[model samples]
Target chain A: MLRVENLSAWYGEARVLRDVALRVDAGEVVTLVGRNGAGKTTVLRCLMGLHAGQRGTVELDGRDIGRLPTHRRARLGLGWVPDDRGSYASLSVAEQLTLPPVLRPRSSAERTGLAWSLERVFEAFPVLYQRRSVPASTLSGGEQQMLALARVLRMGARLLLCDEPTEGLSPLLVTQVGDILRQAKRHGVTVLLVEQNLRFATEVADRHYLLAQGAVAEALDNSAVRSRERELLAYLGI
Target chain B: MTGFLQNTFNGLVSGAFYALLALGLAVIFGMLRVVNFAHGAFYMLGAFGAYVLLAEAGVSFWWALLLMPIGLALFGMLLERAVVHRLGRLDPLYNFLFTFGLTLILQDVVKSRYGVQSSPYATPAELSGSVDLGLFDFPTYRVFILVFAVAVCALVWWLLSHTRVGVVVRAATERPELTRAFGIDVGRWVTPVFGFGVGLAGLAGVLAAPMRAVNPLMGADLIIVVFAVVVIGGLGSIFGSVAAGFGIGLVQSWGEAYAPPIVAQTLVFIVMAAVLLLRPAGLFGREESAA
Candidate 1:
């Protein structure tokens, strides 16, 4: 479970996320839907401690993690797949997967470990196994996305914060990503997604929040996406 | 035939120094992305470290060889954490500026401590004698330098290529953020890697101490030549550094033996200019950067 309250993040002088509040119970798949420049990515970044001017209380499992450095947060089971994929072009897929310092779970932390292996990820996306030896820069857009996800998962992430997961992929690949998200949810990994695609969000997310400017404009369960259609449409300007 | 053989032997010995110095530069450059103006100073200190260990610590040549590099490496780690880490976010030029100032400070400190007069660094009793190889005799020290330098290069190449921690370091060197996302603390690695790279420079200094004059100005004199070697090889390529180091060493050595002694130093610069003109990125520089 995670709790972020009264979070205001900034990049230089411009405020991106102002007084943003959100919460997710354990294993919840929450999609943040808004148009371009909706402060969703800023929220995720602020939580990860990448944004220095972020005034926030980002509590993970009831403990404050706002001030920890990015790597320490990662060890605490936060996986981030940035919008650019942040691919290390020189490294191979296999090298990326098995490379980092693996965090051994403590006695209480053992409950947080999800059972997913490299082979399982390869099975989920066979393209990864097929191009396992290929350098990441050579990967297609969709394959790179898969690699980005697989790499974070390999790092033993409990909460997956994906920024624009479906941004540049084909519809088929988008569906594949949706399947991957569904599978991630089934395995009890919480997902906080920033998405522009309403259809993809509706397909994968159980809970949805609409962000406008820098605040959480609306919070809707999956059913309200259809039920509260006018409110969602008005906010999205669709 | 004897003259040719002697020149060839001399070339290899000089190449060993090139390889040793360039190897240190490449490792630090790859990891830190800092041009390290102070590296030459570190290399100088390595020689000084050996000199002091022998003269002041009452240590023997062999023992100084073992301890000096490690001592310089620790010194390098402290420098990284205290000064270099503070300038991480600034333009890399700031780092160069900072290091340049540090270099001046180091050079002055050493000069004040031990006067500019070149201190003698004698070869140990065991390695002082020359060995006969059928046709002619070769100094034991020069042969040892060639063998040891190549062995160190091989060890470094193997460490970077095969080890798990090395793989992590290599990956992080290329992409720091992605490495961080993988739970690898680059903050922890950067200091030590910087230290190790400085340690290599120190080791090279210790290696050179017996071969050259040990003085404060030694670093300033040799660093420019090492930079030439790095440029001729390509900026950050380890393999290129190795090949260019040895190649330039041979060319310069041969030039000194056959050509005018006054132009021997200039010959290395001339080769560097030619490499820049022909390839621009040196032989092994990354193609993307060349364009």
Candidate 2:
């Protein structure tokens, strides 16, 4: 449901994304796999129009979203979870959940079809419910990640762009996140995840694109990813 | 007992001004994240607008009160669009410096035009006389100022707490990106919100026109005290700003009444320093950086 072609981005005279191209069909989970600083996160940011200086064609269901601001893109149903979590320190877990509900598109069906409510999000991560009124800063890394996911889920977002969802979490929590991703797939949410973890990427990602030196070094479908493991490792230097 | 009542009444009256000015500052700072050095200038503009309406247009005090904020808000929008909006993505210090410079220019312009002398703003004919309090007599103008100030505060509180527009503004103040992501064109809101803040400042200035001196430097000294109020209120906390503004105003009034006049002006600063030393976040302020 999303197409990005010839997408190039830069950060202050340094070219980060060079002629990168990717696509995701409805209900598919796509992964951008790369080591630290492979321009994977930049791809998600550019797609969301978060990058101030981006040039390319980003189409969501055949509409040009390249020139739209981040908010405009969000209103158009693009949900972004940055690598930093982007949590407002002053907002409580509940406040953060309630925040973006006001920014959704003007469709009644969209609002009613929300499978992720405060209760549902809490069910997904019981710890979040326990600390619903607690401020974001006091939450642990795993809890913050859960809050981030819960927040996006609360947005009723059709497309999800998650950056390093498992970077700093414990292995146990990472597994829990993997389970959440599996659950998201069941709900028909398109996910574009940026990950350095091969096991984590393979666990949920339906298709994988290995990025190296600002270009896509390898594109492996879910089945091809397993057989081409050697090629992926060489590019990743894992 | 009479003296105590008089002091309390006096404190409340002054507190009203503090509350109104601080409220505007809080709103502006909350949305813009820039310390508005020109807030007092807007306040001064309101006084001038009131004077102009009364002297030139022969308008009543009530009409000037209503029209001045709207006018100043529009002017504030122009300033925000032309100046403050450009400062976005730059160091916040640039906006602060720019506002500080604007204040000097505005004050100088007003001074050149109007002269550095207090102008008389007559109390409205309807509320011109005093009502007898049980123990002492209070002027009708003072009562009007106090009651209208409270009403304005309540109106502001209602506008901020109850409205959908307020929700968007407050949400933007807390997290601009998230608010934007949620489909709020924060850029569109910035100009109006900034203008509204300046309008509030002008409203406060109009209110003060009858009560205090209306001159070029009228807002100058008060601006410093208002900054102290902002600091004591903790940057951009709305209710904190209101409470601190009034609380400090009362404290200053009490200090001026009981203590030596020489040290009375210093009392507000003392309270601010104490609040900073003890509860650095101000009374109602949240720890924004941590979140």
Candidate 3:
């Protein structure tokens, strides 16, 4: 469960996010669908306490996380996967997977029940296991995405904030990402995803928030999003 | 053949000191992204620390060797916390300039206190005698310096490559944001890492005390040469700094034997310029992309 209210962010005098409000329930996959510059990434950064000039309260499990540092937020069970994948070029795949120390345990039984392990991650993405010793930079785009997802999972993150996890991924890799999201849902790891891909978003997310000009324009259930696909597609200009 | 061997041996002895100094520079530069212009000053402080412990406290050279680095490390940590920490958010050039100012202040203080003349440190009784190798006899202290430097370098290399702390340090060095996201407080490590780097510089100074004249300006002259070695080896490269330090030392030694004095003095700079021209990143250095 995460709640963000009246969140505003700036990049050196230029306001990017203006009074944005959103919420995600426990064990649910919620997506913020927007075109470029809709402030989706900015919202995630604000929630992570990474945006240097940010305003408004971000609550994780009813605790105010807005004032916390990025590392503190992470330690409180917030995991972020940036659009860039943020892989260390010099670190091996295994090192990247193992480096993130797990934060404090979540109180939710569903989250605590799942057996999150390196072996499980390897089973999910066998290609990573094969190239475990190889440097992260040497991996292909799809592999890097997989590595990014696997990394947050390794952190035992209760709430995962993923930005464009499927961007630049192949159709097969996109499908795999969909399957991973499904798996995450089954494990009760709540995901707040920022996506441009409507089809992928619809396939994975239980609810969708359409963002326009730095604010949430509409919030739609999965079925409503499917029925109103044409209008949403036109709005997204995809 | 004997003369050549003798020069090579001397070159290696000097190279050990250069390697030790450059290794510390590499670690500080790599982690903090600060050039640490005061590294040589820290080295000078290390030698002085040994001198103070010996002269005032009547501590033995052996004890000073162990105690000086720890004391200097604490001092370095304080300096980093009080001064360097403030400069982290500013341009790295600020830290460089700050350290340059520190070097000047430290050198001046030492000069005023100790006077401009070099002070001598006696060799430890155990390491005073010369050993006769087949080609020539060598001072026991020089041999100790060579062996001790190599051992220290190996330990540092192992610590960087093999340990968990080292892995975290290396990871943080490459990607601070991602490391933070992983719940690591990378900021906490900065102070200790800086102290450790300066401690290595101090250790080198302790090693140099018996061999070189312990003077305020001693580091000023050597720091330039060390910088040249770091440039040729590649900035922020651990192995590169070590290799280049030794390589440059050897080159300088051979030049002294084979070439004229002025040419010998200028040789390291020429090699540095060549490396910069051929590969701006240095041999082991990665090209830093604009952040």
Candidate 4:
């Protein structure tokens, strides 16, 4: 489980996230739906300790990791898939996959139950396996996204934090990503997603937190999001 | 033709030194993003380290060659921890200035101590004699330098490409944030990497002590040529540094033999300018992505 309380972040003098609070329980796919500059990505960055100017408490599994460094947070089982897909240009797909040393497992069950191997990742994204020896930069946008996701999974991340994983992806690839998220949920991987695509977010996420102007505006269950789809779309200005 | 062969061979020996120095520069620049103006100073210190070990400690040249780099490497680590690491978040120019100042201080210290004269380092007895290579008789020491430089370069390349440490280093080189995100303590590698690079510079210094006049200003003279070599090869490129080091060495030698002295003196810069005009990224440098 992850909990963020009164998270306030800034870029120099410009405050970007103000008193933003959100939480995600284990085995749930939660999404932060927002417009551009709604502080969703900033939220993720703050959580990952990538935002140096952030002030708040970020608790991962009841442990305060706010003061921990980015790498330390990662070693504590937090995996990030950035909006840019953050693939090393010179590294081959196989190299990228194998580069991350698996962090120490959170629990004994995590060690045995969630042993996501390279073979499993390869099986999930067959195209990645096909282009395993090729440089990640040579891959298509969709393939790069898949490689990004696959790499984090191979690192044995328990809590996956994704930023726009479906952005710029084709509908077919988006569907494939959705299936992968569903598969991940079944395997008990907690996901906190920042998404622009409400339709895709609703499909994959069990609950959604709509963000506006650097703060959480609404929290809705999957059924509430579906019933209030038109109202939510208008609120989100979609 | 025999004269040409002899000059070419001589060029290669000098090139080996250039390659060694440039390789260190490349590695330091690749990891730390520091220009490391003190690299030349480090090289000078390496040579002096050997000289001191021999004169004061009663150590032999062979043992100095083996032990001096390790000693200098520790010195380099201390330098990083004390000075270079502090400037990590500052503008790269701060690092440049800091290193430049360190270079001056180091040069002054050495000059004050040793009186700025070229000191002769005796070649090891095993490598003192000349070897006939059919085309010409070559100093056994020069041949040892060539073989040793190549072997070191090869080992470095293998370490960067094949080893897990290398993978982490390469990843950190390309994307530090992402590398850290993979749970690697990239900061922990910085000190050692800096020391390693400095050690290489020291190793070159030790190697050069026997061949060149070991002097206070030796590194100062060679650093410029090494910089030119790094530029022509591609800044921060491992392969480019080595190839360009050797290539420029050969070119410089050939020019010395064939071209006028003044023209030969400026030939390396001319080649560097030409390479820049043709490919601004150098032979092996990748164009940086637009921010």
Candidate 5:
């Protein structure tokens, strides 16, 4: 249940996202697929209110949150999994999970047991528990990605804005991430992913928005995305 | 070896100030990502505030110790709001340059009024005498300084690890943007944290007023060493800054004991160079730039 219209973002004089529009329904897994510099990350950043220079109205569950700060957006149920896998040097693995306060569901219908306890997070990713006391910076790439995903889920985010969750991850880790996404979707979490991996995107996402040069080129269901996978890969130059 | 314990004790006494000042630096850098060249000026203000309190208002040591930090915290918060936050969006070097300019102004303002002479401040009569140690007697105030510094460090450690405020502050300090995206109002913490960091520096200055020459240049000289201490300890790590502060003090003291005066002054820098060459992240720091 997120909607954006006439969203245009810029980096100084250069227009990165020009009048782009997209939507995602509640409990659905959606992806924005595009080539490098297609403004996928900017869209996520704008939705989170981190990108300052933008003109857009981001509606979450029929509420316009376009003017809210990043933290306010987060508290409103948007869980951000950044591309770099936000990890702090001073924070231990356990501290990272517990840092973000869990968001309470505003409506009874929104509750789908997606709110996870620390124990639940540990159960889902035992490696995090094993490395609980160590500095989060010490974790490997795959582990860091898991930590980022697990951190947002632990915070009870109803909507997940994930950026390249599988980038630089191994094949096994990619599979694990896909499973986690599927599981999240099953539990009624609405995820808007920015992914380059077409196969991975098709597997985890129900709908796809293909972005080309800062605008939405096509909105395709899973079948169309699967059928046009090779052409899309060539378009993305992957 | 003949006077190892005595030297160590002396080293720790000076180390106490480095530890306190470095703690503030670490915290401020973690949050603001600014080098804060004006931190020394704040320390000078603390000592000056205490001196002025005594000279102008007949306030005693006990009151000055209690009041200087609070007053400085308010002033610090005001400064943060008025000037520092404006430079936040630009390259970090702009703030660095601004603070550097601020330092010169602060130093000159004090100099214009009080002149460049070192002002004398009497240690509280209660802590003036020497204390009996098993091996050798040490000045009561020096012992108090060491013990009090350790206690403050411990209190800060406990507060950071055990309290809810500490966790939020720590998270925001270490990773501001990410913490915000996690639903934390990180901006709310910035001013207070800066105030707290400045208050810590002021507190150290209050303590120094009785022990060292109360002069504008005092902080300037001490801050150079403290900067080395911060680097050696790692940039934003609280524990690293404190530990490196004390460790560098010991190195400098031992150098003074066995080597020449110039060597003693440069010893901390030498150690810093070695630490940098070996561990670029400092002893306890993470490799990534904080946030």
Candidate 6:
């Protein structure tokens, strides 16, 4: 389980994340939906400790991790998939997959199953296997996205903080990602996703935190989000 | 023609030093984004280490070669932890300036100890004579230096390409912050990498002791050329720096043979300027990763 309480963030003088609070229980997928500049990324950044200009309490499985550095947060099973599929141009696809050293899960509760082996990861994404020997930058956008997500999964990250993983991806690729996330959730991985596509959000996430101007505007379950989809889209200017 | 061949051999020998030095520079720069102005000082230290070992402790060239690099590597790691890493969050330029200041201090320390005079080191008895190349006879020691440097470079290259640690280090070099987010303790590797880079410089310095004058100012003049080689190769590209090192060596040799003294002196800078104009990111460099 992951929890954030009163997480206020700032980019210098300008505040980004207002006193925001949210939580994702184990094996659940939650989404934070917002318009452009609504601090969706900022919220993820703060959770990952990439943004230090903030005051917040981030707890992972009852242990306060707010003071940890990014790598320490990562050791606590915090995996980040930034909006841009972060891939090293110099590293091959296989190299990228194996770059992050597999660390033991910090909390016993967070450890659910075996981390994905190279063989398993290769089996999960056959296209990646086909192009494993090639540089990661040469992979198409969708392929790179798969690499990013698959890397964290292989690291056995208990909680994934994904920022707009579906953005700029083809619909087919988006569907593939949804399947991957569902598969991850089945294996006891919890996710805190930031997505703009509410329809896709409803399909994958059990609950949605509608983030507007850096604060949680509404906490809606799947049915509520579906009922208010049209109004929400218009207000989000999407 | 014999003179030409000998000069070519000399050029390649000089290039081996540059390649060794620049390889360290590129690795350090790639990982830390700091331009290590003290690289030459370490090179001088390598030579002086060999010289002093023989002079004070009666340690031989071979032993110095093995020990100097390792000793300096440990020293480098200590310095990084004790001083360099303290300013990690500041601008990268702070490290650059700090390294430059370090270089001056190192040079002065050596100068104070030995005075500005050149120190002599006897060539190893095994490598005292010349070996017959097809064109001309070359010094046995020069041949050993060439072969040794190339073998070391190849070993380093293979280690980087094939090892898991190498992949992680390479990935970290390419993307430091993102690598951390992927659950990598990139900081854990930084000190060792920095130390390894310094070791390479020290290794190059040990190689230089026999070939060049063992004076405090030896690295002062040579480092400028090595920097040019790095610039031509591309700032952070490891392979680029090595290629540029050897390439500049050959170019300078030919320039010295065929052209005037001033042209030979300016050849590397001219090539660097041309490379900068043609490929600003360097021959091997790509534009910033869109992360």
Q: Highest TM-score: which candidate?
A: 6
- In candidate 1, which residue ranges exceed 4 Å CA deviation? A104-112, A220-238, B1-9, B55-58, B87-97, B128-138, B231-240, B254-291
TM-score of chain A of 4: 0.96
Q: Which 10-residue window of candidate 4 chain A scores lowest in summed lDDT?
A: A106-115
RMSD to native, candidate 5: 2.4
User: For candidate 3, lDDT tens digit of each residue in A1-238?
Assistant: 7999999888898988889999999999999999899999989888877788999979988999899888899888788998889888777899888888865455565445443688899999999999999999999999999999999888888888999999998999999999998998798789999998988998999999988899889999989988988988898888
lDDT of 2 by residue, A19-117 (tens): 888889989998999877889878887887777777889999988889888887887777778788877665677767776753444477655654377
Which residue pairs show collisions in model 5? A1-A25, A1-A26
TM-score, predicted candidate 6 vs. hidden true structure: 0.96
True contacts kept of each: 0.71, 0.51, 0.76, 0.76, 0.87, 0.84
Clashing pairs in 3: none
Question: How big is the positional error of residue B104 in model 2, measured in Å on the Cα after superposition?
Answer: 3.6
Q: Write the per-residue lDDT of candidate 2 for residues B213-279, one digit (tens) a residue.
A: 9998888878899899888988888888888878887898789888998789799889988998889
Give the per-residue lDDT of model 1 (tens digit) for A136-167: 88998888899888877766688999999898
lDDT of 5 at A50: 90
Off by over 4 Å in 6: A103-114, B1-4
Better of 3 and 6 by lDDT: 6
| Candidate 1 whole-model C-alpha lDDT, 0 to 1 | 0.84
Error of 4 at B27 (Å): 1.7
Score each candidate by Cα lDDT: 0.84, 0.84, 0.88, 0.90, 0.91, 0.90
Off by over 4 Å in 5: A108-114, B289-291
Going through the candidates in order, state the TM-score of chain A alone for each one: 0.93, 0.93, 0.96, 0.96, 0.97, 0.96
Q: Write the per-residue lDDT of candidate 6 for residues A1-238, one digit (tens) a residue.
A: 8888999999889998889999899889999998999999999888888887999888998999899888888887888898888888999998888877686755587554436888989999999999999998889999999999998999888888899999999999999999999999998889999999999999999999989898999899999989998999998898
Model 2 achieves a DockQ score of: 0.45
TM-score of 1: 0.86
In model 6, the fraction of reference contacts reproduced equals 0.84
lDDT order of candidates, best first? 5, 4, 6, 3, 1, 2
lDDT of 1 by residue, B1-291 (tens): 988888988998988888888888887887888888888898889889888888887788888778878888898899899889899788898899998999999999999999999988889888989999777899999889899899999998888777887787778777776677667787788888889888888888888888899998888887898899999898877788889999988998899888998888699999999999999878887654210
Q: Could you give candidate 5's per-residue lDDT for residues B9-42 as a string of tens digits?
A: 9899889999999999998898888888989999
Best by DockQ: 5
Where does candidate 6 chain B have its weakest 10-residue lDDT segment?
B282-291
